[model samples]
Target: METVIEVQGLTKSFGSFKAVDHLNFKVAKGEIFGFLGANGAGKTTAMRMLCGLSKPTSGSARVAGYDVQLNPEKVKQNIGYMSQRFSLYDDLKVEENIRLFAGIYGIPRPLIKTQTEALLEKLHFTEERNTMVRALPLGWKQKLAFSVAVFHQPKVVFLDEPTGGVDPVTRRQFWELIYEAAAQGITVFVTTHYMDEAEYCDRLSMMVDGRIEALDSPQQLKEKMGVASMDEVFRLLARKAKRTE
Candidate 1:
């Protein structure tokens, strides 16, 4: 598989503090890569840089075939992002929200209608298209947010704690959507605290403080650490962090 994301000696500093230190990794196209860490582990800072939302203090990264620092706009155009806080207008109707995002992504006006219809049908939300987003259940909103994120067919989608605060069944359903997206050749880069969610990724990187402490498939990490589950592996790694939330 081709590399969709490449990072080399990536670092970010906030005055006297270094939020990301000498980070390095690559994400393969169509792969589901999980980024796991405890609170304040610098995952958010690293992702912000990768998504072109923040500038790196040193080093370089290529996202979706564009240098993040030199071509942040191009990087933004090729990727989609779903934040942990759920970025949708609560006052907007389902169809309205989809249209709004379509415009933001620069999807042609002529194609927006067709794309919106297809998205609604795919998520089985055609019946709720006219309803306000705030009226939908949390799970439905989450799925809708994800659909909107990928409506423009980005090369990669950054999901920042996409399953947070959802029920187990809903999280499972969300993971199904992720699998479908990955199968269709979209790279999925996700950060999640849930161990079970971490296990679902093709591979995972666990961050401690501002650096990655371990990177491997979940099963491999568990085996390497002599643990039987991701929860154990995460606990073991998290305990070594020098920072705390």
Candidate 2:
């Protein structure tokens, strides 16, 4: 496909601390790219920059063909972002939340209704359309949050630790939703602590102390580290970091 996100020498620093250092990566259209790292590894920082929510202290990034620094608004328009914490009005009915976001994106009322119905049915949330978001279960809320994020048909979706607190089965279901979006030509950029979820991604990058230490398919990363699983690969890479430090 096409290049949905491009980064080169992307760096973000706080005082003397480098939160994200010289990161370089590309995500292609319709691909699910995983961003993996332990806490404080700068994954969030890098993601924030890519999503146009934060600026890089130095270097550059482009999202959906718009330069992040010069055209942050354009970049935001073409991308959807879901944080680990769900961002929806708890008191609003599910459909209302959808309408609110649709309005925020300036979508026409008729198109909003049509798309909302289609998405709710496709995601199996149509029956719960009038229910309060606060009453929904954690898993359902996560799904709704994701659906709302991409309701505008954004070219790229950025999910930051979306399944962090979800159970394994729920996480799998969430990944299924992610797969559906990717199949429909939306690029998925996600950060997660779940190694199994990492395995589901088309490609992944592991960050350490603000820089990427490994970038590959999960299977390839395991092979390179002589490990049996992504968890092992992460452990081995982390150990290497400690030794060098």
Candidate 3:
């Protein structure tokens, strides 16, 4: 497996507080890697460092073959990001938002039209292309945001709590999209609080108190921790955490 994301002693701090402490991990190409943790476990802080949205106070990370500190812009260009909050423009129509993001990613003009139609069709959203994003259901917006994030064909896509506040059915549907993206060789690095969602990942790194407390395949972690489910494994590890949401 080709390593698409590599980190060594990655750390982040704010004033006297350490948000991420000496983290080290690697994600392979085409992986659905879960960076799992409770709220305030520094998952978002660590994610921002990896996405090049924030610099690490110490240590190093290389995302998509570019050193994060040295080539933040290059790292940003090679990776797609969807934050915990809805990030698309609600005022823009469905098709307009698609075209706008494609342009931002510098997708060629001729291909944008073709790809835009294909995306809408895939989402069963062809008829609502002219409808404003604000008019759509939350589920529809989540689907569209994810599709746009990966439409640029980035080497990696970071999803921060992407399934929050959705019905279980809708969340499962979103995971299907994640599976499809992974199948096409887009490495997915996702931070999620839902242990059920964590089960969908190829492997997971459990974060507790700004550090990786455990890292392994779900089955392996379960066996090692003497647990039957990812939820149990998470609870056991998270018990050691000093942070709270």
Error of 2 at 230 (Å): 0.6
lDDT of 3 by residue, 1-245 (tens): 79999999999998978899999999999999999988888999999999988999999999999999999999989999998899899999999999999999999999999999999999999999999999999988998999999999999999999988888999999999999999999999998888889889999999999999999999899999998999899999999987766
Clash-forming residue pairs, model 2 = none
At residue 208, candidate 2 shows an lDDT of: 88
- What's the lDDT for residue 53 in model 3? 83
Clashes of 3: 0
By the TM-score metric, which is better: model 2 or model 3? 3
CA deviation > 4 Å runs, candidate 2: 242-245
Encode model 2's per-residue lDDT on 62-154: one tens digit a residue. Answer: 899999999999998899989998888999999999999999988999999899999889878878999999999999899889989988989
Give model 2's TM-score versus the native structure.
Answer: 0.96
lDDT of each: 0.94, 0.90, 0.94
